[model samples]
Target chain A: EAGVTQFPSHSVIEKGQTVTLRCDPISGHDNLYWYRRVMGKEIKFLLHFVKESKQDESGMPNNRFLAERTGGTYSTLKVQPAELEDSGVYFCASSPGGDSPLHFGNGTRLTVT
Target chain B: SQQGEEDPQALSIQEGENATMNCSYKTSINNLQWYRQNSGRGLVHLILIRSNEREKHSGRLRVTLDTSKKSSSLLITASRAADTASYFCATRDPGAGSYQLTFGKGTKLSVIP
Candidate 1:
């Protein structure tokens, strides 16, 4: 089976712009997660979705970021008025269920200058 | 503060040698997982060890968890040059709730040919 796939492996945009990253999870996987890694930092969880409902979103950094998994098949993370601090790698992962190993995508590297 | 911290920020060894990495976490966790990421690639799940389990092995990889100490170790025997990448330890802490995973900074391992 194909692994999780992320769109636009790398994106460069000016600060204050809007960017959207997409992720397609593995087939039959109902659990999806979003994480990010800033420069020289550990990967941090952003949010999680169990099907179409969000199970956790406490990791979201600010109101400028929004994530949605409509219909429980794929996910998209949108950052409005992106800031310089938003430059990092955004990773999306999927798992069979709770307590299962996650399968990740190549990640979308966002560079907001 | 981050929940998990990986010791030895970087490691280098000759092929055919053994490589070991350690991770320490604060608070109780349901399970801990090890992941590998090659340059410019997504993370790949290496192995997972539950709090109740002490040690587990997969081919050349060996993982040991000490819940009492709140630490874990990953051992890769007969390492190959292809193994050069970053190894991260992620913990599923019950305190975090919702099956969220907290990741360590990771150990960048370089296996010399």
Candidate 2:
């Protein structure tokens, strides 16, 4: 089976711009998650989706960040008015279910200057 | 709040030797997991030890979890140059769902061949 896939392996945008990162999870996987690693910081969870419904989004940093999983197939993370601090790698991961381990994509490295 | 903290931010070892990384968390967890990532690459799941279990093994990897102490350790035996990567420890709390995981800064392991 194909692993999780992410688009635009790298993205560069000026501060205050909007950027959207995409993720395609493995086929038949019911769980999708978003994470990010800022410079010199640990990877942090953003949110999770289960079959088009957000199961948890408490990790989302603020309202400027929006995550959606439509049709229960793929997911997208959009950051509006991005700040310099948002420059980092945005990772997408998928798992079969709650008990299964996750598989991550190469991630979209966003650079907000 | 990142709950997991990994000790020895980085480690250097020789090929054919053993590498051990430790992790400690503050809150109760349902499961603890370890992941590895090559430079600029996605993370790969290594092992998962549930709170109810003390030890688990996969291939050359061994993981131990101590619920009372809220800590875990990952051991990679007969390490190879291929083992050079960042190893992160993640914790999933009860009812936090799989996406609510909090990850540590990770231990950068360099295996000199």
Candidate 3:
């Protein structure tokens, strides 16, 4: 089975610019999630999508960040007016269900100067 | 503060040896999972052990959970050089209306052939 795939493995942009990260999960997976890891920090949960609807978004960092999962097959995370702290590796993951194990993508390394 | 913490931030072992890493969480968790990332890339699901289960194994990977202690461990037996990667432990706290996960600072493992 195909694992999760991410695009634009590496990204670099100046502060205040916007960046979008994409993730395509495995087929038939109902649970899609977003996570990020800062340098020397633990990975963190960002949000979760059950199908086309968001089940939980408490993990979102701030208002400038937006996420969407059209048709629930893939997901995109957009950070507007990105700050220096936004620089990190953003990962997307999907699972079969709430109890299923998650499969993650290689992640998109975003560099906000 | 990090919700989860892993001891022995780094580990080194020879081929045929066993690599063991420990993780501790502050909150009560519904489940704990282990994942491995190579070269800071994507993560691969290693194993999952629910709160009710004390132990689980997949191939050479063994996971043990202790709810009373709020800790977990991952043991990789017969280590190979290919096993070099950063291993992380994530915990899902089944809090009121909160289903997000908390991850620990990963343990970097190096298996020398």
Candidate 4:
């Protein structure tokens, strides 16, 4: 089976510009998650989606960042007025729920100049 | 904030040697997992050990969890150059209804072939 896939493997934007990253989870997976890793830092959870509804968003950093999973098959993360700190690799993962292991995408590398 | 912190931060080993990485986390957890990421690639799930599980083995990978110490260790036997990558530990809170994972700063392993 195909693994999770992310779009625009690399993105570069101005510091004040807006950027959006997309993720497509594996088929039949009911759980989707977003995570980001800043340079030389730990990968941190951003949010989680169970089908079309968000299960947890407490990890979202600020109001400027928004994530949505419209049809529950894919997810998008948007960073408005992106800051330098928003430059990082954004990863998407999906699972079958329960104790299943997550399958991750190659991630979108966002570079804010 | 990151919940788990990997010890050594980095490691180097010769081919056919074994590599061990340790992770220490705070707070109670339901399970602990390990992941690997090659350069410019996405994370791949290595293994998952539940709170009730003391040890798990998958091929050359062995994982041990100690809930009382809030720590875990990942051992890669007969390491090869292909095993060179960053290894990370993630944990899910026992009380959290969502399967959100908190990750640690990974240990970058360099296998000298």
Candidate ranking under DockQ, highest first, comes to 1, 4, 2, 3
User: Which digits, one per residue and each the tens of the lDDT, describe model 1 over residues B16-102?
Assistant: 999999999998989999999999999999999999999999999999999988999999999999999999999997877587899
lDDT of 3 by residue, B14-99 (tens): 99999999998888888998988999578887888999999998999999999999889999999999999999998888882545
Give the top-scoring candidate (lDDT). 1
Tell me the spans in candidate 4 whose CA falls farther than 4 Å from its real position: none
User: Which model, 1 or 4, shows the larger TM-score?
Assistant: 1
Candidate 2 per-residue lDDT over residues A2-105, each given as its tens digit: 99999989999999999999999999999999999998998999898888999988889999999989899999999999999899999999998866889999
Candidate 4, after superposition: displacement of residue B9 in Å? 0.8
lDDT string for model 4 (A1-113, tens) is 99999999999999899988999999999999999999998898989999999999988999999999998788999999899999899999999998898899999999999
Instruction: Put the candidates in lDDT order, highest first.
Output: 1, 4, 2, 3
Of candidate 1 chain A, the 10-residue stretch with the lowest lDDT total is: A95-104
Q: Assign candidate 1 its CAPRI class.
A: high
Per-model C-alpha lDDT, please? Answer: 0.95, 0.92, 0.89, 0.93
After superposing candidate 1 on the true structure, give the runs of residues whose Cα lies further than 4 Å from its correct spot. Answer: none
Stretch of 10 with least lDDT, candidate 2 chain B: B92-101
Error of 2 at B23 (Å): 0.4
In terms of TM-score, the best-performing candidate is 1
How far in Å is the alpha carbon of A106 misplaced in model 4? 0.6
True contacts kept of each: 0.93, 0.85, 0.80, 0.85
Model 1 superposed RMSD (Cα): 0.9
